[model samples]
Target: MAKLILDTFREGYGVDQIRKTMTVGELIGFLSDFDEDTPVYLGFDNRYTYGGITEGRFEMDYGEEDDE
Candidate 1:
């Protein structure tokens, strides 16, 4: 198992973190539980080397807000 810190979306500039020890697949599944449109930050320690904005489900937002 590996430790991970997740930066979950809360609002415009708000974020919450979840620290746990789990496999990468479990971490991915955990991330998938949230809104795919929102950005996420993944890290094991002081630095976040992975995670991004696009979930690979659609084109880039380009600053376009969702119709909803």
Candidate 2:
């Protein structure tokens, strides 16, 4: 199995927050146990070096309002 590192995130106070970190094996195992199509969130560093499956999905909301 391939080794992987991961970070977790969640929505809080209208913002995303880091909840924890996990391993790829652990994540895949957990995911395998669950029914397919289950929603999840995978976190990654700014450089995209580390990431893992998450319980909640993360999304970017950047738009014109945030643009300068």
Candidate 3:
């Protein structure tokens, strides 16, 4: 297992971040809290972050990390 890093910035909500020592499986449940339109940035260990647009799925596991 590795650390789970999640960050987000969206329309209504301001910037948010979460750091936890968990695997991919644990991330799904936590992600359910956000709306489909919510955008998120995900990272594993010390790797580059991936950006994700939560637009349709009720829950998501991955997204491209757009830091620009």
Q: Please provide, for model 1 over 1-68, each residue's C-alpha lDDT reduced to its tens digit, 9 standing for 90 to 100.
A: 33334644333442124344477798688878666556554543345454544457546445436532
At residue 7, candidate 3 shows an lDDT of 49
Better of 2 and 3 by TM-score: 3
* Most TM-score-accurate candidate: 3
Best prediction by lDDT: 2
What TM-score, over all chains together, does every model reach?
Answer: 0.29, 0.28, 0.30
Output the lDDT of residue 34, model 3: 64
| CA lDDT scores, all candidates in order | 0.52, 0.52, 0.51
Global Cα RMSD, each model: 14.2, 12.2, 14.7
In angstroms, how far off is 9's CA in candidate 3? 18
A best-first ranking of the candidates according to their TM-score comes to 3, 1, 2
Residues 1-68 of candidate 2: C-alpha lDDT, one tens digit per residue: 33333353344654334355456797678769655755444445543654445447556668566553
Residue 49, model 3: lDDT of 46
